[model samples]
Target: MKKNSLILSVLLVGITACSTVTIKPEGQNKLVNKPTYQDSKPFYLWGLSGEHRVDVLKVCNKNEPLQMQSQQTFSDGVLALITLGIYAPHTVKVWCPKEES
Candidate 1:
């Protein structure tokens, strides 16, 4: 029905609007094609009480990351929405420099 369509449309818009991406530049011309590591960070109380810390050195095997990205993906947004903002999560990605030849 029209009501169902409207609800779906609103949800789609909300999920798309919630996505956010932040990239940190490390002065590298090229980065690895794939992420060195990817994981979801969990937070409680609408992200007010949990720590968002990623051990880049550990993740990159002691190498510096060429770039780092944190994003609120569609799945992340859905999880938060399901929890009614009580639980929030973010996806983090890191790209390491290519191994020296």
Candidate 2:
């Protein structure tokens, strides 16, 4: 029982190692109500082995975000750590500026 519990605890830690991070344009506050800016279609699965895969999201140090809003999770890295890279999937969100009339 103790061995099983230990394994479960470790797995939990590994899975949670990767978490979502959100970034917004400078001086732009994340409002409580969703904005009408351009946003990436809801996406799922982001890893080498996942069904739907895309480049991992990253933030450039000292660089501003290209879009107005961005959010991402390094699911691939966490899955690789937990499953020896056998499984990896990432989830991301992007919001661009709205077009002016």
Considering every candidate listed, which one attains the maximal TM-score?
A: 1
- What TM-score goes with each of the models? 0.71, 0.38
lDDT against the true structure, each candidate: 0.76, 0.47
| Number of colliding residue pairs in model 1 | 0
lDDT of 1: 0.76
| Cα-lDDT of candidate 2 | 0.47
Across residues 46-88, which tens digit of lDDT does each residue of candidate 1 receive?
Answer: 5677887888888878997777877778778778778877888
Q: State the weakest 10-residue window (summed lDDT) of model 1.
A: 23-32
Model 2 agreement with the true structure over 28-100: per-residue lDDT tens digits: 6764344333323232333433343223233223333344334334544555556654544444444434344
Best by lDDT: 1
